[model samples]
Target: MDKLGIYAVPAIIAAIVVFGAVKRIDLFEAFREGAKEGISSLISIAPSLIGLVIAVNMLSASGFFDIAAALLSPVCNAIGFPAELLPLGLIRPVSGSGSFAVLSSVLEKYGPDSIIGKTASVMAGSTETTFYAVAVYYGSVGIRKTRWTIPCALAADLTGMLFAVWTVRLFS
Candidate 1:
């Protein structure tokens, strides 16, 4: 299985090349065009990606996440959610690495078998990096008006987080 994984990508690439040849497609030209498109897409999304990274870093450095987590503790506890996982839920949508740090903290403190650790692991696995996806995909396409995207994505993230907790509680 491990060896198969190593060959899988090369096999896929070889298949694509054969398919393109069968279709009489100019592979080198096609590859060049795709590379150019990718670079352009990267250039288009760069500003939004940079801004998001800076904002996430600023929030982390300013202790906004810590403050928000502290403030949200009461609401979380009221709903039977573990307050320790609040920061993970908050950061998961904006930054994967940031949420990962919070998840690591939870695992270290609570142990993986603990309810909090299970919830954190589930939340991390289930939730999307909402802001990053929106910025990258929308920006790459030059879509400036994301009217319903933010609210809808956030609601989905919240649903995933809540379900993560409930699922852990229900199953464990």
Candidate 2:
């Protein structure tokens, strides 16, 4: 499996080159153009990525997550969800680093073997950083208006968080 993984990309690229040759296309030129396009896309998306990082840092520093967690605590407790895991779930969709920071704190406080910690691990594992991904991908592609992307991704994240807790509790 490890050896196959190591050869996967080169195999895929070789297949592409062969296919392009059969199509009478300039494979090297196409590859070079793709590299250039990728770089430009990276350049275009860099600001959004940097801003996301900064915004996450600011939010983390401002204690806003703690306030949100506190406000949501009662509801979470009633639902049998740990209030401590609230911040990680809420932040996961917006910023991976921010959510991971929350997860790290939870692990530190609760220990990694604790129920909350296992749930956090599963939540982080199962969910995507929706807003961050959309911001970078859309911005790079010059998309100004997004339709249903945020809502759908957040819905998935919420569902993932619930399942993470449910599955963990099922085993425990």
Candidate 3:
């Protein structure tokens, strides 16, 4: 059953493609149109994504992120998360790629089997990409008031980090 689950979506897609081809329904043209639309949408959102990347990089390089992690360290320690993961928690809510890079660095520095690595991995799984969320929501609605979203998302990420650490400790 699990194996079938892996193949199910592809199987359905393959069935549709075969059927469409056999029925002479211009399937290739339809797919090309869909691809073109996807490209256009991606292009439309390119500026927002670039701004997100630049803002994240500036925050990280300006030492604000380190300061934030330091400020949160005590509370994080109280919640069972290592002080080291505090920075990752801060970044996770703001940038998925940045968070992933932090997670990878943590894993490299403190092997995957280590408590910190496991907790970070679990946190990654439990947390949502917050900045991406804001970008999509605001971009869709044309709302520019992003001031509140970051704090709200960071709170959620912190909760997820605490939960992940606690749960991992229990099961490991």
Candidate 4:
């Protein structure tokens, strides 16, 4: 079953080619046209993506996240959350790559087997990069009004982070 799963994608591709042949479709030309469209789409989204990445990087570099993390520590401790996970909680919603960098730093500082490391790993997996998603997806589609997307997504991320900490303690 596991080996069959690995072959599924190839099987699907072969089926698509066979189906196209039976339909007398020019698969190669269609594929080329699709590739060109994809390239054009990339060109459209590139600027927004670059700007989003730059903003995330600026937030990480400004030492502002650290200050915010410090201010949240007392409340975190009261809830049994590890202070070290603060950066991950804050950064996870805005940028996946940024949150990943924070996760890597946490895992390195506290060995991967540590509670903090496990919590960070879980949190990373369970959260989405909300701001980046909105920027790329909405910008690509030309949606101007976000309409409660940011707040809802950030709230979900906060919920995930809290559960991750609690889950780590339950198991460890």
2 or 4, greater by lDDT: 2
Worst 10 residues of 1 by lDDT: 48-57
Task: lDDT winner between 1 and 3, please give it.
Answer: 1
Candidate 3 structure quality by residue, lDDT tens digits, 48-148: 66666566567666877568768878886786567777767777777766676677666876798798888888888788888788899899999998877
TM-score of each: 0.60, 0.60, 0.55, 0.59
Worst 10 residues of 3 by lDDT: 48-57
lDDT of 1: 0.82
Clashes of each: 0, 0, 0, 0
Candidate RMSDs in Å, in order, are: 7.7, 7.5, 6.8, 7.1
The alpha-carbon root-mean-square deviation between model 2 and the true structure, to one decimal in Å, is 7.5
How far in Å is the alpha carbon of 22 misplaced in model 1?
23
Clashing pairs in 4: none
Question: On a 0 to 100 scale, what is the lDDT of residue 53 in model 4?
Answer: 57
On a 0 to 1 TM-score scale, where does candidate 2 land against the true structure? Answer: 0.60
Q: Write the per-residue lDDT of candidate 1 for residues 53-106, one digit (tens) a residue.
A: 566556667877678779888998899777778778778998766676667666
- What is the lDDT of every predicted structure here? 0.82, 0.82, 0.78, 0.81
Model 4 worst lDDT window (10 residues): 48-57
